[model samples]
Target: MAQLEYADGIWSGIDEAGVARLEIDRPEVLNALDGAASARIIDLCGAWARERGVRVVVISGRGGAFCAGADVAGMATDAAAKGGFDESDSRAIIENGSRLVGAVRALPMPVIAAIDGPAVGIGASLAVAADLLYASARSYFLLTFVRIGLMPDGAATATFAASLGRARANSMALLGEKLCATEAFEVGLINGVIEEPEGLDAVVARAAAKLCASSPEALALTKAALDAATLTQYEAAIDREIAGQTRLLQTPEFQAAIAAFSAGSR
Candidate 1:
């Protein structure tokens, strides 16, 4: 496999069998994404979309954790420096994050998420955005946006509902609970769960290899059809999330929540 490094902690390469692997390489912060990393992900996905030789795409993170979520600390600092969250910052975040999710879903070939740890907030969104999701036994999914007085973005409002039904999705979003790998599999949220990271890697590799053996045209068409059927509300959900989150970000309640959360973490 030939590997290349991209900015904002992204590493990508194509294997001999035409499987492209993308890794979020920031282990220090559990692969939490800031604006630059998010933008890089969008760029990588766009590049893969144009690569005809790539039969499947595998996304994972370099650290033990897949992704903890967005860079809350960074965002808090920026907000504090700027006299709090403004409309411009909120709009940029929503636009950039939506674009990232859209890019992942737009890929013609199958996309797999090899999750080995926490996938929270927008990270959870990215995982569900993939066609297939494989998780390690230690992995968990969380949507804690409500805990910070913000709503979920990255089209999660749609993906979660489409994957796990309304009641379950509501529980996660409203309660801010952690869904472990086993529970995720039982709830039909993931394709498979393995006991170890190596096992998860092997399973994802086998699945990718199997997919590569099939007819690419057929796979692409089938994926498109399934997405059309299931993700009909995806665009609209994103739009709603952006509008709602923008207003929420400017709310006094959300600002206070962010401040308290930040202080508690310290």
Candidate 2:
């Protein structure tokens, strides 16, 4: 098992037991993903999927967040450099964001997401893509897309509605509210929620060990069957999101919201 050099805030390594770990470390910005980070994740996921020795994959974020969504500062800078975020720029983002989620979903082995803090916007979407999601009691999920005058991307449309139902998904996407980890557990959005502050790592470690001990063939088949049955509109939703978000990225409301976001909050 060779340790990988951290790139774009992402650190990855596969252990001797074939259990792989992917960590996102951008605590200052709450683990927000820039284009480079997104690309690195996508590339790593692809490579792991092809590596026969990799058994189970666990994803987590360092320091206080699973992920905060996209790096607004990066996007703002890129847009300013180009005068505006055109369709080309929009597609570039969609490519990285969408493919990153797709890579996670398509992993051949079991994928576990251990969320300890905030998972907002696309971050929430990405976490839900994991086959098993375990979050800490203090962790919260939010979709801030509407606040930024953009529709949810990263296949959130399907993942949220599928896990949280249409009404709850509407509550998140339209109202842009935060759903605490306990609430997410009650709503059946997450597999489990650790009540203790430091309990998340122990839970994730146990899950990974359990997955590693299980039959790989049966696990893969079960995952495929479940996804086929429930994720009926996942692909279509991704396409729709890309189309909708691209257009929204060029809208005045989105531009104004982004400009204000730089001054006030992310």
Candidate 3:
């Protein structure tokens, strides 16, 4: 079996049954993505897109939580050292994030997200970007960018709205509220909610097995057609997010919010 690991705690490899598992392995920080981690995800997904042996891909976080979000502390430190956040910094982050989301959608095989706990900010985007999303009862999805004085990125604008109607998507993004697994299921944000983490894992495994049995070309084409129908504005939304986030990052209000958030975390 082919396997690859990255220093940032991302692991990718094909299993005995031809299911490719891509794991975010930073449990200490709840798998919060730093630049390196994000880059690794983009690289791995891109590589796996062309790997014929991989029938399906399952993405999950190793810790109790799926992914907390980005590395806010790291970003704050960078901002402090640089005197303020710049457009270039914001653009690079947004672009890399966009690529990660895009890679997931572009994969020829089905992509499943096994979410165990909190999926916030871009983490929520990652979960929703998957072709199938399964979560534990303890898991929740949160669009928390507004709380931090930023807008949602990672093509969340398109993905969320595509899964959830405009009204629900607006409420979630505007409120920055935590949508629990049950609520997520009721709202059609996720495919299913299991009672436990182990159950969620089993659900994903079964789904992957089912997908693996299907015709890959048919699955890929069907996914492409679905995306074309539902996510017509995905690329435009990403461009808009990058532009808006760039402006937000350079604002005094956003700087103050980050400083306060950083202090509160400490």
Candidate 4:
């Protein structure tokens, strides 16, 4: 049964077995995330995780792509409405979305990301935050924040480092390159990859069902331990990212970059 439904975006459901699935529903826009959608997703995930029967949670996107990235249209509209990009606006956007990413990390039960296609920018961050990642062979992880002249937010600065180590994370963040599912699995960024796209659902469902068999208390404790070990690091990374972003947003370099993109100059 469909568990939760919303108008703007995002749909969630928990099966009788207590396995929950949260699907990103904005396919026409390649499931690009915006403030309103992210906020709703965060709220629902938190509430569902707290419920008694929700043993495991799976997050995926509709259509061919997992999530392209932030809604460029929304960002452009917001920036225009506010006169121009400013430090305050950038910080608010980052902080608000970071909270949602953090919420997924803090979920008591296992949170799995099922990526069937491209997962870019903050989408990459969200996938990395999951306890387990199952991706189709065609799926890729792209950190496009740099391409857009924005520093990584969603706690990815730390999450990427922890999952892929310092050098790889730095390369991805600095270069804004796309990493294929196989490459991500090799680097320990993702848990596994399925060769057949059609097999993704079964693969994720089977894995999540296995997780559901474990003691919920034990699962929660395990998640807490993992999170505790990296809490300080994530916090520090978030602070650094926010500060760097604030400075960058105020710079003429970034402003020109945004303007160029908005004008389709590059």
| Model 3 RMSD in angstroms | 1.5
lDDT of each: 0.90, 0.90, 0.87, 0.83
CA deviation > 4 Å runs, candidate 2: 1-4
Clashes of 4: 0
lDDT of 3: 0.87
How well does each candidate superpose onto the true structure, as a TM-score?
A: 0.97, 0.96, 0.96, 0.93
Candidate 2 vs candidate 3, TM-score winner: 2
lDDT of 3 by residue, 7-71 (tens): 67788788877798888888777898898998888887888898898889999998788898888
Which regions in candidate 4 have their CA more than 4 angstroms from the true location? 1-4, 230-232
Each candidate's clash count: 0, 0, 0, 0
Root-mean-square deviation (CA) per prediction: 1.2, 1.5, 1.5, 1.9
Estimate candidate 1's alpha-carbon lDDT, on a 0 to 1 scale.
Answer: 0.90
Clashing pairs in 1: none
Structure candidate 3, residue pairs in collision: none
Q: lDDT by residue for model 4 over 124-177, one digit each (tens)?
A: 888888989989999999888777677888888888888888889888999987
lDDT of 3 at 155: 93
